[model samples]
Each structure stands twice: as C-alpha cells, then as structure tokens.
Target: MSKKKLLVYGSIILSMLFWSFSFVWVKIVYLIYNPITTVLLRLIISSILLFIIGKGIKKLQPIKKKDRMQLLLLAFFEPFLYFMGESFGLQLVSSTLGAVIVSTIPLFSPIAAYIFYREKIGIMGLVGILISILGVSVIIFNKNLNLIASPTGIALMFLAVAAAVGYSVVLKNMAAKYNPITLISYQNLLGIALFLPWFFLFDFHDFIYAKPNIKVWIALLELAIFASSLAFILFTYGINHIGITKTNIFINAIPVFTAIFAYFVLDEILTFQKMAGIFIVICGLFLSQAKLNFFRK
Candidate 1:
C-alpha cells in the first residue's frame, strides 16, 4: 500500500483504539454526573483543545451563507441531537442493547450511501455488514430485551446515528473549503454553542455541585482530548482517504474492545453470552475485510 493509504488506515486504527476504551469511561461518567453534564464537559474540553491547536491559524469565519444550513444540520445531529438522544436512551435501555443498536450504524451507512450518493456495495461489503451486525447482536442481546425504550428516546438515538452517518456522507464535500483542524474546531464550537442553552438550563448547576473527582476529570479529558477531538479528526481523515465503507469497519472492533476494557477497568463481568457476542462480532469483522480479489497476488 502507498504512504497515504498507510497513514489513513493507521489513523483509523488509532481512532478505534481511542473510541474503544471510551465505552468504559462512559459508564464511569454516568455514575457521578448526569449524561448531559458529561457530554457538555467533553465538548467543552474538546473545543478548547481544538482552539489551542488552531491558535496561530485564523478560525473559520462567520458561517458561509450556503454552508450555514448544512453546518447547523451537522451540529444538531452529531453533537446536539445525537448525544442527547443516546444519553436519554441509555437511561431507559440496557447498555448492551444500546451497543447492538449503535453497531448497526455500519450496516446503515452503506444503505445511506447507496440511496443518497449512488455508491454501490459489492457482495463482500454486504457480507461484512451482515456478519458484523450479527456478531454485535450476539454479544449485546440475549433473552431479555425490552422494546419499550420510550418511543421518543429510541427515535432520537436512531436519529443521532443517522445524523452521524449524514456527517460522514457530507464531510468530504466541506473538507476542501476549510482546514481540517479549523473545520472540526468550528464544528465542536458550534455544537457547544447550540447546546449552551440546554446546558445552562439543565446541567450547569449540577456539575457545579457534583464536584467530579480526579478519575472523573481524567475520564472527561480522555473523552474530550482523545476521543472527541483527535479521534474525530482521524475519523474524518480516514473517511476522506478510504471512503466510508472501509473506514467504518473499524467500529467492528468496538464491541470487543469495550468488553475487554469493561472487564479489566470497570470489572464488568464477561459472561458466556458476552463472550459469544464478542466472538460473533470479531468473526463478522474479519469477514468484512476479506476481499479475495485483492489478495490474488
């Protein structure tokens, strides 16, 4: 593979590692702070880091007339609407169930891509998607799934995933006009601004009294610095370099990594069902990348 391919692929892997461990942190965060507070702190820290990185360069100026609607839409879905929906859903649904639902994102990305952009998924791509979803399902859900996660909450979470998929689909179109660092910085800032009213109205006072401990602070920083800012940049780079189908396969590893981290760090049990799920997902992930024609050499 060429240097560009190597860089993009490597970046995707690193982003996966960062995101993988974040699952553990997410649970830890919920223990102390409300989900909105946790999410807000993350966005705040992340926006600060991006701002620091882009200090010398001029920031993305006033949103362009043409781009304003699109940018607002991106912020609403990815950061504002998506986070609120997922966080609320977690309160109602099992985390495992939620993971299974979120993992479906990869399955859905291709469909979204195909319907909107006229992208085609070959036979291998379809197989990979199905296997990954099956694997995720096996790991996350067993006999006890309650379909009654408030219809509104469920709709919001699914919408969040859809919105993220939208971001991936449209990201390439905007990356050309602005610096990646500047663009992400502005995006996060925009998200922060969008949620400012919600934050103050709901979470501002809570975090003030919550006095998040050092562990909480560390976890939040990890969320902000690595997962939110750095990982997002890497994610965008990979998508731009490799296309969405290939870049999103990295999510296939999240279930396995999340389980392992939960086991070691959080002491979440690795039950037979969980193990089965991991095994299934890994198999699917491996299968997803098996393009035989590429290996004929």
Candidate 2:
C-alpha cells in the first residue's frame, strides 16, 4: 500500500479499536448512570470538546441552509438512534453478542449503498458476508445450538446496525460539503439537542443522585474524547477516502477487539469456540476485499 492508503487503513483500525473499547466503557458507565444519562453526557462532553477544538483552529464553518436537513438526518440515525439501540441493547444482552451483531453493519451497508447509489457487490463480497455471518454465529452459539442472548436484545442490536448503515450512507454524501471534524461536531450537537428532552424526562433524577467515582469519570472522559470524537473523525475520514462498503468491512474487527478487551478487563472467558470464531471473522474480513484472477481481462 502507498502512504496515503496506509494512513486511511490505519485510521480505520484506530477507529475500530476506539469503538471496541467503548463497549467496555459503556458497561462501566452503566454502573452509575442509565442509558439516557450515559448517552446524553457523552454527546454533551464531546460536542463541547469539539467546539473548543474547532474554535481553536478557526474551522467552525456554518452549515449551508440546504444541507441542514441532511445533517439532522445523520444525527438522527447515529448518536441518537444508534447509541440508544446499542446502550439499551447492552443492558439486555451480553456485550459479546451485541458486538457480534453490530459487526454485521458491513453486510447491510453494502445493500444500503446498492439501494441508494446503485453500487454493485461482487460475488466474492457476498461470499465473504456469508462466511462472516457463520463466524458470528459460532461466537454467539454454544455446542447445544442455543443462543445465549434474548430475541429482544438481538433485535435492538440489529436496529443499531441499520442505523449505522444509514449513518454511513448519509455521511459519505456529507463529507463532500464538510470536513470530518466539522461534520462530527455538528452532528454531535444536533444529537445533544435531540437527546436533551429524553434525558431530562427519564434520567434527570438518576443523573442528579448518581455518585460516580473516579473510575466512572475516567470512562466518561474516554468516551467523549476517544470514542465519540476522535473515533468518529477517523471513521468519517475513512468513509470519505474509501466508500461506505469498504469502510464498513473494518467493523468485523470490533467483535474481535471487544472480546479481547472483555477477556482482560471484565474477566470474560475466551473459550475455544470464541477463539475459532474470531479467527474466522478475520479471515472473512480479508476475503471481503479480495479480488481474484476472475476479474482479470
């Protein structure tokens, strides 16, 4: 790969790692706060930090009046619905299962692209999607073939997946008009606006009375700085450099990274089945991008 390609790929991986760690961080935050409070505070802090950064660099360009609707839609799908689904979903299911389901975003993202942009998927890519699904199934099921997660939890995680696909599709178009920092900052602000009412309605008392310790505060800072802000900037940059389909393929790594993090931090078991599943998921990720001699002239 050239230097530019390497940078793009590196940024994608960094975004994946930041997002992977967020699974752990979310669990940590829930120790003291509810989902509404967690998501609200995350967006609030990230929006403020991004505002300060944008002002420091004098890159705070106002959104075009015509583009405001599209920006709102982006926020609606992402920090709004996406976090709502993922956070509440985590409460219902194991983080491992949630990560596995969210990793399927690449599968649906390409379909969304094809629906909206008429992009075509090659045979290899479809095969890769199937293999990755099998891998995720292995991770989620035991020898008895029973799913460890509830159906409601699975549905909520899929909601997150769908919202993520929408976010990526909209984000690709928006990148033409805005840089990554401005887009993320503005979308986060819009997300805060949308979540404020819900937060106050549901989590206001929880927020006021919750006694968060130093550890929870660190997790909140990590979410605002690394996961919410920097990860989003890197993800948006990747979507701009590559298309949504290619950018989303990296999501398969999230489950792998999250599993590892859980093993070390939460003392979750890294069983043989999960290890094999992680290996297969990695293989599927590479296969999804492989172009064989069948494409030669």
Candidate of highest TM-score? 2
Local error of candidate 1 at 75, Å? 1.3
In terms of lDDT, the best-performing candidate is 2
Across 201-221, the per-residue lDDT of candidate 1 in tens digits comes to 988887788867888888888
For residue 213, give model 1's deviation from the true position in Å: 1.0
Model 1 has an lDDT value of 0.71
Candidate 2, pairs of clashing residues: none
Cα deviation at 272, candidate 2, in Å, is 1.7
